[model samples]
Target chain A: MRILVCVKRVPAPGAKINITADGRAVDTAHLGFTTSPHEECAVEEAVQIAEAHGGEVTVLTLGPAEAEEQLRYAASVGAHSLVLVPIEEVDWDPQRTAAALTATISGIEAAEGAFDLLLFGNESADAGGFQVGVRVAHALGRPIVNGIKGIDVGDGSVTARREIDGGFEVYEVPTPAVLGVKEGINLPRYPTMKGRLASKKAALVTIEQSTEAGGQLRERLHRPVEQVSETVILGEGPEAAAAVVDVLEELGVLA
Target chain B: MTMLVLCDHDRGTLADASLEALTFGRDLAAAAGVSCEAVVIGKGAEGAVGQLAAYGAAVVHLASHDVLTDFGPEAWGETLAQLVASCGASVVTACGTDRGNEVLAQLAARLDEPFVANCREVDPSGDTWSLTRVQWGGSLLEDATLTADHKIVSVAHHVVEAAPASEPAAGTVAAFSPDLDASLARTVVTDRVVLSRGITLSTAPVVVGGGRGVGSAEAFAPLEELAAELGGVVGCSRAVTNNGWRPHSDQVGQTGTRIAPQVYIASGISGAIQHWVGAMASKHILAINTDREANIVTRADWAVIADLHKVIPAITEEIRRRRG
Candidate 1:
């Protein structure tokens, strides 16, 4: 039961977003990148599945050189191996990202063996494009159970629950399948210091081949006008309550 | 040959989301210089599919089967793969609701095709089609081309406004029966629990959400009572979900369900950009918070700087005591 968890390095959920001065891309100079929120859950699921079944878990990521940070993080958190496909050119869309990931996974499979299961987050948080997982599955020609919230593996097949119109719909798919892990599927684990250290030293298998997939995305680089403001949080002192009360009443809270 | 849109339905009834999907599908396919068809998937949705013609579908492919009695993702994905192949649709589209996106993702995988989710708009340019998807939680737009002979797309909910049917045009309803492998499904839902009488926050006209500032679980009672009186639904911020006081389904934020209602009354919410992205699409928003400097006050149409503990109970009591 070999499993591959696909991930992306994106600005953290709480990270302050600053568009580049040119307004074509997010300004990452001061921002710290981490595994996408949902990807963390996906990686956790992979580790849990690997621990439950006898297998190894590998993390795959596609991005610039700095994207390897997330791959190293994955290795620290119990993944057996990490693979990074470099898209040195900034702003690779999902099609290209999926292609690069496929090429890297193909090389890995050719060397080792094909994966039994593939896991992905519902979507990346920063880019918020929910396309890579499905695109990868399609490129590989595998059966897929998507956006699964509840999954139980047995009977040589995987049973998963996908949230439907009102409730949930259960689906059974054979092994050698791709499935996107939905939010609330499981609890994500934090990387330990030991894991972090191990991951940093872990060599990432980088693939340089291009998968001839094209899609236009340069238009997103344009900037939008924003009226940014700030709120100074008064220190959490005893007087803070008095100050807050005064402010609230001045705004007509207490008549 | 025209493109086909899968119509989602509830036991013999059509979902409004499906209608919205139908409208989007019809408009998109027509813009691409092709006619549009619809496939209804659910138990006994054959009759309901016939009404899709009002939204411009020329054919409503009905796949009513016993194996489909339950919404099996594998079975449905297989059925769609077969239907798409047989119909030879250049593209298929669905509403970006939870179910629509889930099923569409599976179908895209099964068809071995690329998919674009939460696309806000699609404009055809000769042989190529351009789409603008909500990038970065709707903060920015990613305008790109489809660049595929076949593509699956999910339109963002409410982004493509649903217009009334222009005319009642009759279309052919073909019954599509496909074989489903029951043993392949991983999990099966044995039971369902409906909260707040099944009034989902996404469909509610008025949503009253509570956050960490609500102080305690007991504070939700006022919100629930108020929602009940207003004939609306109760929602919450991610803080409540993080606190484990509410299920993730009730959470309203960037990662949670995005809702746009007529009126949104936020209580105790700090108005984080994530929360704002979810509910700021509402027609009107009223913020109730003790912090006059709260971001919600600026994003909201109206601001009431008050302690929700006192203001909410009073509002509910006033409404209840006011009577019909």
Candidate 2:
């Protein structure tokens, strides 16, 4: 029941995202870095599954060397091992990233035994390409599904639940499957002091690799034009309540 | 060379989002001087051909395999991949729904091509299509280039309105049977569970959205009361969900649910770009916050500079009084 989870280091953006002067990447000077929210939950889910099933959870990340911090964070929260595929660039297109991961995973599997399951965030919070997991799974010749919330492991198979409009759709894939986990799958645990100390002493594994840029190439990044609205102040505090009602009535939401 | 659009449907009814894809495909095809076609896969796909025609699909490919009776990413992607090859499609597009992105991603992976999701604009004037796509939800835009033999892209949802063509196309229906192996059904939907039934946050006409200022889970009571009075629902920001004050299901943000209610009552929310992308689609927005300079207040159509604890309850009482 070995599980591998992939996480990406992204800037924890504030109210606005400031692009670099070159317009190619996000300005990180004023921002702090953290793994995407959904990936946090994915790491938590993997650790929980391994804890229950008597296996080890290996956390993998593909980013700059600083991403080792994210891998260590995963270790602090119960991951048994860490793997970092370090890259020099700010980001790679989905295809290139998936290719690098597929090759690295194959090499890892050849060295050790194959993992039973591979987990990824539904999409990276910043790029939101929504395809890396699917691409990697296909390249590795495994069954995969995205937007999964609940996962139940069983003998030789795993049952997953994907949220939809009304309820959820269920899918059961065999061992050696891939799943793109969404947030809310679990509330990730906070790192304890003991866990932090252990994580600091844990061994760090780094894989250096680079792949040719894929077809999708970034030209620049820019902000979308903001919709300027002249807000009409109805009133102040509780006194404005009647004015709000009038506006709602005018909008026809109320009679 | 043809532009192939994948139309999504629920049972026999066509999804509104697919209409947007159709519109985008039609325009791109016209610009490229190529035929625009559509593919609707799964059961009841025939039901959408007429509407697809009205939206300017020159040919509607009805694809069905024994394994495609239900939604499966691999099966559907295989179907689309076969269609792309058979139709000689130069570009493939779909609405950026969960299923749309998933199926097309599978197709891209099978073909080993680059697929861009949530694209606002794509220029096919050159050998490589230049694209402006939504990143970080709709808050930031990325200018990119897609160089592939067959470009695959998904139009961003809610970015464009679905409209019918002034003059409809022939919309000739062609039955398609893709070669699918039984193994593709491994990821097919095995069953379904209906958790709760009713208006959801995305479909609600009125959404009372609360943020960190809501204080606690119990503090959402005033917002709930206000929403119930207006026959709406209560929504929360990612901050609230992160704080464990509300479930992620109730969150209105890029990572949560992208809501397009008629009127959104956002309270105690600073309106970060991530949250704004989800709420910006609302027809009207009213911000209730103590900070006059909050991002949500400045962007909202109307603002009530006050605490939501006082404003929300008062708004509810006023509605009750008027009804009486």
Candidate 3:
């Protein structure tokens, strides 16, 4: 029942996102850093599964040294262990990141034991390559399902549910499988006072990995054209109700 | 070398997003001085070859196998990898739908190459191609470069409008069979559970979204009724889903379904960043919230500063009265 959750640290974008002067990255001076939303939920899901099944939850992250914050956050929320695959660069291409993660996971499993489940965010909030988890699963020779919202552990099998347009698709993969979990899987818990204290004292395990760049490289980062809309106040409260209908009719929604 | 566009279809009907991918692949092929072709996998793909040529595909490769009767990411990727080699394709592209991205990712893993998803623009001028891709579900854009000898990409859904050539190419259809192991079927789709039929949240022209302000699960009745009257479906913010007022499938946000409805009627939603990302793609947004300064109100095209409980029924009544 052991689970490993992979997370990524990304800039916590606000109402408006500002790009760096050179158009190469986000302007992080004013913004804070947090685990990607989906991965945060993935960590929560891992912790919940471990808590219920009587096993340990290991949280792993690949990013700069500052990514330790995300790992500690996972520990504060009941993760039993933490592993940081520290990368010196701002970001690693998906191929290299997957390779590094596959290597790290292999080493961990070899030393300890194979985790029953490996969970990753459906895609990173920042880069959103949507390849790392699939690549890693292939490299590790495991069946993988992406965009999973619900997971049920059965006898040596995992039933994963993914929501489609009108309904959901189900897949059953054997244990020692991989799943890319989405955000709505669970609501992440906040760190308690005792948990925060434990997190502060928790030892952060760092893994040094150097990998070559993948074929895809970040040339620069640029902001999309801002969509500015001037809100036209129809009316106040129930009184504005008629105007709302008028707008809908004008938009042909009522046709 | 040819540029290959992977046509996404259900049985025989082609998806609009796949045509968009063909359009993109055609442009990239032109830039690289190569012919633009398309590859369709699985059952009923042979029927889509003509349509692929209408979008400028000169050659259509139909890769149908017994094991690939349904969508299997690994099998499709493996098939595309073989087609890339057999057809001498320098670049492979697909529409960035859920399946398209998944298949291309598998192909990238199988070939040990780079694959970019949600690309809005691609320039295949030289060995190194620069592209702009969406991040955070199109909330942000990233400029990146691909230097792979065989470039694999997925055009962001709805970024490029699909257009047919003035004169159709009358493309020839060819069949391809890849050697796929039975092991790839391990993760294939086993069962599909249709929750509700007809228009879904993604395809609904009008979406009525409820938020935490709706108070309880029962409070969504009004939103549902209004959506029904408009011949659409109901959506909700993550907060509503987190509160257990609605299911996760009905949630609209960064992690939820990214909708492109004609108009989104978001009621009682404060419009957090996550929710805004999903709803932003809608053609028009009408925010109904008490707080005028709420993020949804400020960003929406139209705002009604009112309690949704009072406004929703009133609007429904107004619409009914107008029809009568």
Candidate 4:
């Protein structure tokens, strides 16, 4: 029941996001870094799965050396192992990221036995390309499903649930499969004092990998014009209640 | 040198997002000095060919197979990959819906090409095409470039309005069947569990959303009643779902359903960034919160500074009173 969870470090944006002067990237000077929200859930899911199944959970990430913070965060949450695929560049397109991950995963699987499951965030918080997980799964020759919210381990099979408009769709994929898990799958746990201490001593494995950039290149970033609308205060409390109903009626919702 | 638009449908009816994709593809193709064709896959896809042409598909390619009865990412990706080669398409595009993005991802994997998702604008003017895509839903935007010989992209949902040509094209319909292996079925949809019958959060014209101030699971009754009175559905924030006061399907946020309701009545919700991304797409937002400085109140089109418990019932009563 060994598992691997992949995560990405992204800027923790506040109420307003500011872009860099050149418009090439987020202005991170004032912002701190944290694991993507979905991947935080991914790490939590992996740890819980390992705890219940009596196995180990390994957390992997491909980013700058600073990504070690994210890996340590995973370790603080009961992950047994950590691997960092350090990239020198500020960003790698989805294709190169997937290729590097595929090669690293192959090497790990060859050394250690194949992990029963591999988990990735449905999409990265920054790029949101929605391709790396699928590409990596294809390269590794494993079945993959995206936008999964629930997972249950069965006899040599993993049942994943994905939510749609009015319902949910389920898939029963065999072990050694891949899943792109979204947030809300589970509420990630905070790091405890003991867990934080252990994380400091946890062994960090760094893999040096280089690959060609993909066809897509980032030219620059530009913020869309803000649509400013002045809020009209109809009334206070139940006094303004009539105005609210009038607005709803005007919108034709109160039919 | 043809641009290929992948049409998405629910077996019988075409998705509005796909028509939007066709509209986007038509413009991109014209800019690239080529024709815009469409590819429809899976069951009941043939029935959508004419409708696609009405939206300006120059040629419609239908790929139907027994195994393609349900949505399988691998199979659809493989089919699109084959179509890209057969049609000699210079660019492939789809709506950035869950299925659309997933299928294009699979195609990118098979062909080892770059695929961009949630793009609001694309300029295929020169060798390096500039793209503006949404990140963190629509809270932030990224301007990037695509330097691929064969570009694959999925337009962000609802970014462009779906428009029909002044004169519908008499597009030709062609059939296609790719050589799909049995292994691709491993991740196919096996079963479906429908929780609600109708008026889902995404499709509901009006949505009544609750938050932490709503208190408990039982407290949602007022919100539900308000939604029912408005002929809409009830939605909630991630905090409400995290508190177990509402189901995940009813949650509105970045990780939850991205809704575009005509008006979203958000009560007691201090809007967080995650929740803002999902609710921002709504045409109009009315926030009811005790805190005037709350994010939802500050950003909403209309605000009522009051306790939702009293204001909700009064609004419902007002609507009922006026009708009587």
Candidate whose DockQ is highest: 2
Residue pairs in candidate 2 whose N, alpha carbon or C atoms collide under 3 angstroms: none
The TM-score obtained by chain A of candidate 1 when compared with the true chain A: 0.82
Task: List clashing residue pairs in candidate 4.
Answer: none
What does candidate 1's lDDT look like per residue over A96-148, in tens digits? 77777877877899999999889988888776667677667767866665667
Q: How well does candidate 4 match the true structure, expressed as C-alpha RMSD?
A: 1.6
In angstroms, the error of model 1 at B20 is 1.4
Computed on C-alpha atoms, the DockQ of candidate 3 is 0.71
Off by over 4 Å in 1: A13-18, A21-23, A51-55, A139-141, A193-198, A201-203, A215-218, A221-255, B64-88, B102-113, B176-197, B215-222, B228-231
Pairs of residues at least 3 apart in sequence or in different chains that clash in candidate 3 = none
> All candidates' TM-scores?
0.84, 0.98, 0.95, 0.96
Model 4 misplacement above 4 A: none
lDDT (Cα, tens digit) per residue for candidate 4, span B117-215:
989988888888888899877888888888888899999998988999777877798888877888778888899998888888999999999999999
Chain B TM-score in candidate 4, rounded to 2 decimals? 0.97
Per-residue CA lDDT of model 2 for B41-111, tens digit only, reads: 98887778889999999999999889997889999999999988997888899999999999999999999
lDDT tens string, model 3, B125-222?
87888989997677778888898888899998878879997788768888898888988787877888888889988899999999989999999998
**What DockQ score does model 1 reach against the true complex?**
0.23
Model 1 Cα lDDT, one tens digit per residue, B1-324: 567776777667877777888788877886777778888775767677557888778888888555676555556767888888777777888887666776776776566566777887888655567787776676666676776667778887777666646875467777787766655333223344333446677777778899889977777998898777677778898778767777777878777777777678788998775677788677667677888877776666555677877777666655554353
User: Per-residue lDDT for A121-185 in model 4, tens only?
Assistant: 99987778898999999999998999999999887999999988788899989888999998879
Higher DockQ: candidate 1 or 4?
4
In candidate 3 the C-alpha lDDT for residue B299 amounts to: 85
